[model samples]
Every structure is written in C-alpha cells, then in structure tokens.
Target chain A: MTCKECRKRFVEARYGELNAGQRAEFEAHLQGCAACAAEYRRLQQTLRIMDQREQPRLESDFGDAFWDKLAAKLDAEDAPPAPRPPQRETPARVLRMFDWPRASRIAAAAAVLVIGVLIGRYFFSRGGEEIPLAGSRETLLQPTALEVRAGDYLEKSKVLLLGLVNWEAETPEAVALDFPRYQRASRDLLQEAGYLKTALEDSRQRRLRALVADLEVVLLQIANLEAENDLSAIEMVKTGVDRRGILLKINLEEIRRAQSLPRPGQTSGKPSI
Target chain B: MKDEKELIERAQRGEMGAFRELVERYQKTVYFLALDLCGCRQDAEDISQEVFLKAYRFLPNFRGEARLSSWLYRITVNCFMDTRRKTQLQTLSLHNDAPGENHPPELSLPDPGADPSAPARSHELQQLIRRALGRLSPRERSVFVLRHYQELPLKEIGEMLEIAEGTVKALLFRAIKRLQKELAIYQAEV
Candidate 1:
C-alpha cells in the first residue's frame, strides 16, 4: 500500500473499524515502512496518555438530595391554593326577620304561603315521578341527576390521570406524538371542572368542593401542556398529577360502584328525587 | 439489559425509586464523560445532574430503539454543549488564559519525575492531555471525548451527534491530529 493509503488505514485501524484483510495489509505496510511505524507508535502513546486521566469522583452523596429537591419542586408547583372559609346562614339574621316594615312583612308572608302551597300541590300531583328543579336546595341535599353527572366527570378525570401516571413511551419520538389524546381529554375535563366549580359555589359539601378545586388545578395544568410534547411540559403535567395525589385521591371505580347501589326506598333504574 | 428496561418502564410510570436506580447506575459514567468534555470537576457535577434530569424528563419518549446508555450519552453531550455556551462569557473573563485554573485542587498534577512516582507521571500526562483537549474546537472535542474517552463506536458517535459515520471518522482524525500538534512539545520531552 502507498503511504497515503497506509495512513488512511491507520486512522481506521485506531478506531478498530478495519476488517481482518485491511488490518493484515496495514500491518504488512507498517513492517516495511519505518516512518509509518514510528507515527503509529506516537499515536498509540498519545491515546494511552489520554486514557490515564482519572474519572472525577463526586465528593458526597447527592442522588437522594437531588431527587428530594426535584420532588419538592414538583409538589410545590401542584399544591392547591388555601381554601376559603365556608359561608353559612347565622341565627342573628333570623331575628332580623321582624325588623322589616309591616307591608314588607305581609308581602314576605304571602310569598312563603304561596311557595308552601305550590310545593304541597306538586308532591301530591306528581304521585311518584319526582324531578327536582335545577339549583334547588332539595336537589343539593339529595342524590340528584346532576350529582350522577358530576360523578361521571370525576371518573373521566381519574382515568386520564391514571393513564398519565402510568404512561410508557415506545421510543423517545413517541413521547411527543402520544400526548394529543391526553391533551384533548384534559381540555374536555377542564370544561367540566369549570362548570362543576360554578355549580358547587353554593354547596356546603366542603370536602367535595375542595376535591373539585384540586382536580381543577391538575386538569388545567394538563390541558395547558404543550401539544408538541415538550419535556418541560410533560414534566409540569406529571408533577401536577403527582403533587395533587390525583391517582390516590380520586378513586373512580369506588365512586362508580358506590353510586350504582340503590338508595333507600328507591327501586332499580328509578331516578331518586 | 432486561433489568434496565424494567427500570426504564417503571420510571416512565412516575416511579421515582426506579428512576433513582437508573441515576445511580449511570452517574459515574455520566460524570466522567462530563469531566472529560468540560475539563472541570464542578462543571462536570452540574452537567451530570442536568443530564440525568433531562433523561428523566425525556425518558417517557425514549423508545428502546437506542440503548439507554446511548440516549444518556446523547443527553450528556447536549448538556455539556449547553453549559459551555451558557458559561462561555464568564469563563472567558475568569479562565481564558489559564488552561487549568478552575481545575480542582485535588486534580493538581505532581512534578513529573521529581520523585519517580508513577502516579506523578500519570498526573502530569493527564494534565497535558486535558490541555490538548481544551485547544480543540467544540465539535472536534466532542467527537474525541465520545470516541476516545467514552469508548463509543463511530456509528454510535455519529448517531449521538446526528452526523454521518464518514463525518465522524473525519472529525476523529482531525481531533487526533490536533492533539498531536498541540502536545508536540511534551511529546519531544518524553
């Protein structure tokens, strides 16, 4: 082989990319050529020197601390806002009922009498089909159709969170491609969560309100995640899911099963009033 | 390999414990790769942390098409490049002239042949190699670090850098030639 060919082969040989035939030819050239052999030795020595550099050692244990800090950041980002105090009617307001003008008092009494008669007539007239009016106090008190719908919304949210928490990527590229379904689901849930939030404003179910509020935050985070499947976006959504403990807190299966059981005095397939 | 795949699958599912295992398994290799690329211990540590965090963030999408180690090496390279770019202005003002100024005190080389200590000679040679590496362009430096230091094959290096295999070989050849040129004075003495 010519010197140029031998030198080219030398580079290939250094990388161990040369086949046996090429290696034999390169070795044959090296044996007869003093200059090429000397150059090869120098290259080997430089590589040996480079390899002698020590791998830097960390001074202390950092893995646990680092993971802890990351987890804390994630949790902090997902933590819900402080709950507001519950609004309630006080007895002091009841005593103020007599403070109104005589005409106002007469008008209030008449309104109440009319409402009572209407309620009595409705119960008597309906016989068995009891449909509570929307936004009624009785509807809030009993298990209404709206509550069943709310339960359904919660169930959907639970499935989304489970999918996110247990997500697996077949390839790195798959991560970005696979999140549109999640984004769409989150968007749908965000709309439902908002409606539920407004509906629950006058509700006294403090625990349910609080749960919905937390679920709203998680849904919002997921809904707003970048569609391109950005790593930071994914991390943000994952952190929100983990921070709110959504997977653990919202048990859809249990909620669905509980909601399915018959209420007292209610027949199967009959809507409770 | 199966164990690694299992750990990855678990980590993808938001299992911090499984991810931590992955971190511990690759920490040393990641640290050394960063050190070789950045030529400083503190930067290497920071870069190593960034690498694993990026890995975790991107792990969900990491289709087993490439080895986990290759994915990590790709991340390490990107992290190193990012860090170098971010710190370039500061590094210029602080350590432009002094090649080994930011090198940790523990990394200081002992006098060569002063005590006939093999370790001293090794340290001296390591310092020379680091200086030579510092003289190369970022592309050349990365190609050399991945190929020579990390012992990654040429095809893998090409994949990590998103360059052709022929380009990788060309870079490696250029890197070694540059190193030989830069370390000629030390070579003569030896």
Candidate 2:
C-alpha cells in the first residue's frame, strides 16, 4: 500500500487493535520507513500523555450548595400553589338560610314564575292575531271547546294525582288505579323525558306517572281542606284550581306542539293529539 | 445493590430524601461526564443540575430494567446535546489551563521554542490536541473521547451513544483521521 494507507493503518495500530497479519506488515513497513517510524513514536507519546491527563474536578461543596439553593427556590414555588376553593360543593347548604320554608313553597313559587313566563311568551308571539269570541263580537276570546278541554285536562290531572298518592282513606277506587309503586321509578322515567314537560321514551308510562303525581297533589290539598272543615281552605283550593287550569291549557298546547313534531317511526306530518 | 433498588423505589414513590441521596451519590460522575462532553464548567454544572432535576421529575416512569447510572447518562447526554445545539458554542476553552507561566510536572511536553526535547511543549501539545478536538462535530468528538481518552469499549460507547457499533467505529475512524491531520499541522508548526 501507499504512505497514506500505511499512516491510516498505523493510526489504527496505535490503539493495538490491528489484526495479526496487518500488524506484521505494518511492523515491516515501520522498520523500512524513517518518517512512518518517527510518526508512530510521536503518536504513541501523545496517547501516553493523554492517558496521564487529570480528569477535571468540581468544587467539593457543589452538591450541597446546589441542593440548598434549589430546595429553597422549590419551597418558595410550592408555598401557595393551591387555588381558592369553588362555591359549588354544597349548593343547597349555601341557599338554606335565604330560601323559602319548604320544598312545596318553592315549587309553588316556581310554578307561578313558569306560568307567568308562558303567558307572556304566548301573548308576545301571537302578534295580536284576531281570535274571535263565541256568540260575541269580542276579537280576542278563546273558543269554548278549548275552555272545556282545558277544564277536563285539569280535572283529569286532579283525579290522576289522587290515584298516584292514594290521597284519602275513602278513595279506594283511586288506590285501585294501578299506580306507580316507587318515586325513583318516576324520577328515572322523568330523566328519560329530557324535560318535566314531555316524555321522549315510553310516553304512555311517563304520561300516566306525571298525570298521577299532579292529580295526587291536588287531591291531597282538597283532603287536607275537608279534614280541617275550613271555608278559607276552600278559597285556597279555588285559587289553585284556577291557576292550575290555565297551566293545563298551556301544557296541553305545548304537548300538542311536541307531538306534532316528527316522531321516530311515524311519517305523518300531523300530530295525534 | 438492594439498597440502591430500594432507594429508587422510594424515590419513585415521591420520596424527596431518597431522590436526594441518589443525586448526592451520582452527582460527581454526572458532573464529570458533563464536563467531559461540554468543556465549559458552567454549562457542565447546569447540565448536571438539569439531569438530576429531570431524573426526579421522571422518576416514577423509570422501570428499573437498566442501571440508574445508564438511564441517568442517557438523560444527561440528551440534555448536554440540546444545550450545545441551542448555544452552538464549542467547548474547547474549558481545557485551556487557567492562564499562568507555572507548569505542573506530569503534564510537561516538548516545546519547539526551547530545547529539542523540551518537556513543557509536551503538556502544551496535549492541550493543543484537546483544543483541536473542539473543531470536530459533537458525534466525532464524543466517539473520539469515549474511545480514546475515556478508554471505553466500543460496544459500551455504542450503548451510551444509542448508535450501532459499526457506526461508532466509522465515526471514531473519521475523528482520528481529522485529529491526525490537525496533529500533523501542529508538528510542522513546532
């Protein structure tokens, strides 16, 4: 080989990693060539000196000092890391002192607000459409059939609720109405309805249960008034019936509107209600 | 060995004391290796600190299949390489002995300026070799340092570098060739 090839092999040889035959050939070449021999000697000397060079030493206190400083910084960072707690944990507890006396009182207030909202929305969305009265020239009177149907819906709801709660000892017929046995079952069905106002699944069962719960509440109020034998209680019942009658009308309209919307299996564009 | 394993297990459980012990025991090796890779003392110190900090952060994920030193070295090398890439600063100046006319005995080498066999130049020549090493690519410098100066076996160097043995060999060969070229120039200058 040439001088460059020999020098390359010589470099490899300096590490004592050359193969035996190559080492022999390299030795012969080194004996013959003064420059290669001199180069080999110098390279060996460099390698030996490198072996003797001291590894760098760090400051003796580096670890302790570093940890001390780092720990202090980390401690400072961690001191106040937690955020303020949110107020949502016990919502009922928070509102306890400021709220209505009982669940029923809250329910009655909510019912009033809901009824007021529905009435206002209905008037606003109507845009003054002329609704003629029966046997009169009044341009904004509701139909008598609608009025009768509204009364029937409320009356039926009262009967159903009486059946739902088995409201009185005398109401054996209401108790025999195949009423729902558990409030939890009704709650689960209500959950599936997607709203208190409608049922999207098992509509027959949901409707029956909802109608029963409503009727039971009304009947329970009547029974309480009758048991007390108080005329003032009768007036309270009258007010409840009047307000509930209007809600039943609005709810029936909403139920009609919902039923008219496209159902899963029916192709008809019209509502069954 | 079981003590190390138990310590690692405790460290994995978020035990700060156990982790600190691990750091204290291994800090010297980590710092020296960092210094070897990055010639700047400050960069070495920084890399060493980062390696320990990162080890603590990733402690729970350590599976204990490999020695902690090997795993730590892997992280250290990555951290050093990342810093080197970001700075693009070569680290030759760290080895430039603190400037003084005073020379130590074991380190002396021949000086062409003085007697033909002058010993001071030998140490200076060794320093020159180290300085010229900075001109090499990090991979070449790494392979050269690990193979020659560190006297690490090629296979272990391959493991530390995460490269195939043949590739390490090729890189080491190229590095030696470059060093020889630089050394030849230095010899002529002398």
Candidate 3:
C-alpha cells in the first residue's frame, strides 16, 4: 500500500477490522516507514492513556432517582406521571398470604391434589381424551430455559469482567480498557446474576450456582467502583475472581453445555429443572 | 431483565417499570456519551435526563426501525446540541447583535495562562487530553467518543448520527489529529 492509502486505513487497522490482505499490506507499510510507525504508535498510546483514566462515578440509585425526580417534576406541572406499569403479583407474595404452618399447608395441598385428580379422572372418562403432555414433554427433553439463560448470563459477565479481573495496578496499560462500559455492563448483569442464583437454588448445577454467586460479588464491586483511584478495591475484586477461577469455570461450563446439547429427536441424560 | 425490544414495547404501553428498565439499560451509555461530548459531568447528567424524558414521552411513536440504543444516542446528541445552542445564545445576548455593533470581549471565560501558580502537573497527561477533547465540535466529539469509548463501528456511529460513513471517518480523523497534536508535548517529555 502507498503511504497515503496506508494512512487512510488507520482507523480500520486500529480497530482490527481490516481483512488479512489489507492488514498485511498496512503492517508492511508501517514497518517500512518510520513516520507511519511513529504516528501509529502515538495513536495507540493515546488510546491507552484514555484507558488508564478513571471512569466517572454514577450514583447507585441514579436511574431510580431520576425516574422519581422526573415524576415529581411532571406532577408539579399538573402532568401526571406517564402510565404506571401494571402491578404484578409475585407467587412468593401470594403464598405469603396463606401464612400457614408447613403441616397445614401440606394437608391443604394434598386435599387439593386429590380433588384435582378426581376432577381430571371425571373429565378423562367423559371426554375419553388423553391429557396434553406434549408441552411438558418437549420441555423435559430440552435443557431447562434456566440453563440457557444461565449460559447467556455467564457469557456476558465473562466478556464484561475479563478485563477487570485481569487488570493490575502495576500494569495499567496492559489492555485498552473501558472502565465505564464495564461498570454499566456489570450493573445490568447484577440483576440477572441474582435472578439466576435464586432460580438455580433447587437445581443440580452446583458449579454453575457457585460461579454465579462469585460473579455477583465481583460484579457488585465493578458496578460500585468509586470515581477516585481505588486500586485497593479493584485488587480485592481481582483477587476474589482469581481465587474462585470464575472465568475458567464459565468456560468449562460452556464446553460442558455444548457437549451435552441434545440432538434432534434425541434427549441427553440431563436432570430436569 | 426483559430484552430490549420487550422493554421498549412495554415502556411504550405506558409501563413505568419497563421504561425504568429501558433507562437502566442505556443510562450510562447516554451519560458517558454526553459527558464526552460536553466535557462536563453536570451537563452530561442534565442531557441524559432530558434524553430519557423525551424517550418516555415519544416512545409510543418510536417505530422499531432502528436500535433503541442508537435512537437514545441520537436523542442525547440532539439534547446536548440544543442545550449548547441556548447557552451560546444566552452568552452572546450580553453583546450587541443589532445591525453592525461590535461584539464585546468574553469576560466570563477565565484564561488558563492567567494562573501560572496552578501546578502544571507535567507528569499528568490526562488533564491535558481532557481539555483538548473540549476543543472538538459536537459531531467530532461524538464520533470519536462513540468509536473509541463505546467501541462502536464507524458505520454504526454514522447511522446513529445520520451521517455517512465517510463523514464519520473524516470527523474521527480530524479528532484524532487534534488529540495527536495535544499528546505531542507528552510524547516529547518521554
């Protein structure tokens, strides 16, 4: 490539989006030209310096408080807060209404089960129809939706935290880091991690469970990173991630999951959720 | 917890929770983007609030032709630009714009060179780089920040800004050139 052509492709080259042939030509041009090489090095160094700077601190309840403040502002203007979400009745909340002893709850459940069975038998006899088991059967044949969700959660967290888990204060320029992006992703993943942890509470995925719990602590640390230089906090988080080998575990689980994916018309010997 | 598409759909239906979720998802993206373009955290926060409020109001009409993040980003840039224009006009109002009146000198802006006692912090390049970023136009700053800080593709940034990829490239090139000039002093010290 000519010097002009090579210089024009710097953006693409810096982002590693150039095709192999183009990349090869660009590298060759840089190698042969001292001016081009120096310019390229300075560009890379500029980005590295950007990376080393601390991320701007955001309030923990920033989103929540913004919504409330906006709502109040609108209310003062006599414009009611935009339509509120429909209140959802959580199953746990519904169950809490019963507030009965375990024995009494079990007895009630048994009575309901007997009554349901009798009604089902009556329907089966009268309609002479088999129960529709297809939906449940299909779900059993595949992995729990939770596994897929867990996999996705783990994959995202792994990508987001990899830079953070590996960052060392002594070698701050080791990677082209984006502290703000990591902080945001960690905040998003924090909710998913908690949900997944609770969903996996009764499951057979022990390693997956532990990994997610570890991810929670690490992600929390990342999401709450203060504005100032808090190298000690980052180091503690890094140490926790390393001690738990969370990244390695995520990779291993992914491999395990890939190997265990059920083929068409076949089901693996996987525990049902 | 919901996918972005679902969140938008629900938020459009006047669901506060869904709108909140949507905001949570892209809140920082919008905040930092504003911060980079404006070079001030307080302005960034105001811009973000305005962007989200506009999203909440006009969401029912936000046809899903574009990604929600891109739409929000476009709103952020527009909000920043509008705020900047108003501030500029307010500042300029102090001067005479009638017919052929001479403009008054800017007395509000303190000169950096006026304070020699201010430690140079020659070892610190971050402050210098941050100040240099303030010299860029809104479009140039957005292009550079989205490309580098957000790691967005050039085409994606162009689409978000409603500019052609070539224009994005030109803007980014100019921005980097400016930064390179600023960083030269630091490089010389090394």
In order of listing, the candidates' clash counts read 6, 11, 0
- Highest lDDT, which number? 3
Candidate 3 lDDT:
0.71
Cα lDDT computed for each candidate against the true fold: 0.70, 0.58, 0.71
Q: So what's the TM-score on candidate 3?
A: 0.50
The candidate maximizing TM-score is: 1
lDDT per residue, candidate 2, A1-273, as tens digits?
556677877545876777899898899888888898887787665555446544543456778987886566556655887776766657776677454545444454444444434433432245664122222342321333333333334443333332222222232221221222223222322232222222212333454345534444544565444333344654565566566663464366557645645677868744344
Share of true Cα-Cα contacts across chains kept by each model: 0.32, 0.09, 0.32
TM-score of each: 0.52, 0.45, 0.50
DockQ sort, best first? 1, 3, 2
Indicate whether candidate 2 or candidate 3 has the larger TM-score.
3
Provide the lowest-lDDT 10-residue window in model 3 chain B. B102-111
Residue A61 miss distance in model 1 (angstroms):
2.4
Report the C-alpha lDDT of model 1 over A1-273, residue by residue, as the tens digit: 998888876667987989999999999999999999998888877776676666543546556665665566555555796686864658875656555555454554454444334433433355664332234333343445556656666666665665555443332222223356566666666776676666767765455667778988887877777555466776677788777776666675347548877977778875565
Query: What is the Cα-based lDDT of residue A150 in candidate 3?
Result: 81
Q: Whose DockQ is greatest here? A: 1
Model 2 chain A worst lDDT run, 10 consecutive residues? A171-180
* Residues B1-190, model 3: lDDT tens digits: 5678888888888787887778778888898788777766667778888898888778999999988887888898889879877874122221224654322212213333345463446324445556556656666777988888878899888888889998998898888887777667876776
